[model samples]
Target chain A: MTYSIIARCPHTGRFGVGTTTFSLACGRRNESLRPNVGISKSQAFYLRRIDPFVLNLLAQGYTPAHIARLLEEDDPDFEYRQFGIIDRENNVFAYTGPRIGQWAGQRVGPYYAAYGNGLAGPETVEGIVAGFMSDPDAPLEERLLRGIEGGRDAGGQRFKGQRRPERSAWLRVVDRLDWPRIDLRVDMHDRTVAELRRIFEEFKRCDAYYQECSRDPRNAKPEEVVMSELSAA
Target chain B: MTFSVIARCPRSGRFGIGSASYTMAIGAHCDGAVRPNVGVTVTQSAPLLRNNRLALNLLAQGFTPQQALRVLAENDAHYDYRQIAIVDREGAAVAHTGTHVRQACGQRVGGGFVAVGSMLANDKVLDALVAGFESQSRADLEDRLLNALEAGRDAGGLKGSKGPLPERSVALLVWGKHDYSDIDLRVDLQDGAIAALRRMYVDYKPTAEYYEERARHPRNAIPAMEFADMLKNKQKAMS
Candidate 1:
């Protein structure tokens, strides 16, 4: 019922998660992130409580593969879940449980993990990887959003000949700050991927202003002024 | 730094809040609390997360909006810097704007809704918000709330040193009978936050009922792609 890509940018060291699902609030439930540490995603019967534990394991110097093994050993419902981990060093690992659902699969690439359950076919995960790899020089957030869009284009979730819409979508990126650099969610929408992209494009226009606001509040111009300047330019 | 409207749909019994601010993450920071069948509240202008929870707790205990406001006023030491609005399940709405809040700060109460703001461009902002909401009394709760926020923004949202400030963040949250929200969309950091929020709402509107149907009656619910195909076929036949 869900498809996602978790990756760390080699250029900026930023970690991000881009995801869409047939249910509601996939953004709030599936992802866990620690700035400068790593990113983790748990789906396919996702337990929201496990995300923090995954982050903690990453903080403890556990590799992505090691963390998956530990989860398989410790969690009783591990067989029902799919996990993805990408550390700050761009080390990546992904796991798809056998009993998760039909058309479930995962694809691992350098610094990224693309995975899904109840998808239309293996092409969904393949599209995600191709999208992410298509632009190594772009910002991590853009690449992640594009990756999920590629999944949607390749045919999203499907079960028993009935295709489900990607109703909820989210994009979360964290830099070195305690807070996320970009955190956007479409909790419920027909065009989840498109809506996420629209907002991301809008946010990108003033992304610099926000960064300045966080870094130096006193000297930062109001967002309106910055926008006007950008438009004039 | 912010302006918002918290409302309940008398027709559908849904609670919704729409907010826009010059600051980042207004949805996470300024959004107070919303409980299904209880009430909705928003606290801004030096907001405190605990106050939002407290207000919701009080409303859940069957307190009126005004009474909840009084409790928040009495317990909060920095009440003078805070602005709060609450709408109960009964459609009774109330708001408090402290005297120490920034210039152009005020609030307006209409039937089933409360519009509040601090550091606004002018007093017209709240009035426009109220007018926009009341104009769409027959619309969905989410639509009405978004209309109010858009009207507020058009009337000049935040008051900057020279002119109207740009909204960096905006959010819309609507809750039906379910424990989860029917819609929870946020433009956490954007210059045209209200516009982005409106786009999200428009995109989400068509699928709202589908999700509800899926949750309530999974056996009868049509798959989203199949549903889209059906609609396309219907359109083709009509054409």
Candidate 2:
């Protein structure tokens, strides 16, 4: 049904999620992030509230594992839900509902969690975890993008019922702001992961400009910077 | 330049985007950001990811779709180089196409959607996109989006980009309240990419719900059907 990655950026201390699926907007329905709280994603029979709920508990100082246990205890439909949670402290956790679609599970790294349900095979999550862990020094958004790309290449969504590739994808990065620093989606596309890569390249190009604006929106002038990048491109 | 639409499903609280272009993977590079219960925003043409980030942030901060554009334009030094569209959770919409975009560029904002285009063969491409969405209001968000994409193709996509030859790239996206899209598909650097996209969607739609049910009630999830059986049906339908 879906594949997702949640991570804490060592550079900016932000939380991010990059996700995609055979379904529609996995980013919108699956992800929950709050500044200084934690990141949560509910997929595979996703319950939207679960993300917010996990964030609340994370804000209340619960450890990632504790929060997962608490959520499991609280939901009668827990068996139908797959989730991943990562907090500000870089604590990571994941769960797969007992009844989730085939090839459903997750992998956790020191500061990241990658999970999927209805995946093409085990390689999906494995590749995502490897990609996320590949470049520890990269920006959070880039790492997450790599993870999703890996998942897609290793066989993203289940193919038996349809096309081999997943149709939609989303990537989001957040820092101190209430809004996402990079929020992008391919809601319906055939080459979802490849498209995500192109958009991410643009995001990387504009990141410095975004940082400049964040520093001083009233006076920030990114025209020179952007024009320079365009020339270079 | 490209032709694209961002639409909402009033019935299912879904948001979809469909676009075609002479460029490679135009939908991926310049598509929008969607938050299921919040809103959607697209930044295209001389697309600036910084402005796109700003727009999505503004939308999250409770700016109206119109206000978000105003704020972005006010802050961007190269505002005229951008094209943007937004649809709030409540279905309100707004769009902006800058003068700096390629010739034949424009955007239309309707009740719950926006269609924007640049370097189009004709203004009718956008019109066809809108008409496709309107005429197929009863279809699922994915089908509606594909309909719009198909109509835009029929109306002619990018100028000098269409013939018996295939499109360089195309993409379709539909977002519901799930972590995954109801449909997230793209056709990049392919001949007949639009046709390929339609075929891909048809193959996926029927089984989408089975996976959804697997998520909601795995206890009752259907057994994996044989791939041969699924292909037979697909082939039969194609015939």
Pick by TM-score: which candidate is best? 2
The TM-score obtained for chain B of candidate 1 when compared with the true chain B = 0.87
Poorly placed runs, candidate 1 (over 4 Å): A5-18, A21-102, A106-115, A118-168, A171-183, A186-233, B30-32, B74-77, B212-223, B229-239
| Candidate 1 docking classification | incorrect
lDDT (tens digit, per residue) of candidate 2 on B1-239? 56788877889888878877654455545333666677777777665555555676787788888899899889877677678888888899999988767667799899889999877778888899899878778888778878887888788776632322236567777777764455666665455678877876676666656655554555665544443367568789989
In order of appearance, the predictions have TM-scores of 0.61, 0.67
Candidate 1 overall Cα lDDT vs. reference? 0.78
What is the per-residue lDDT of model 2 for residues A72-186, given as tens digits with 9 covering 90 to 100? Answer: 7877778778888888888888888776646688887877889988787788899998888889898888898889988887877774555455767887777775656666666
The top-ranked prediction according to DockQ is 2
- C-alpha RMSD between model 1 and the true structure: 7.5
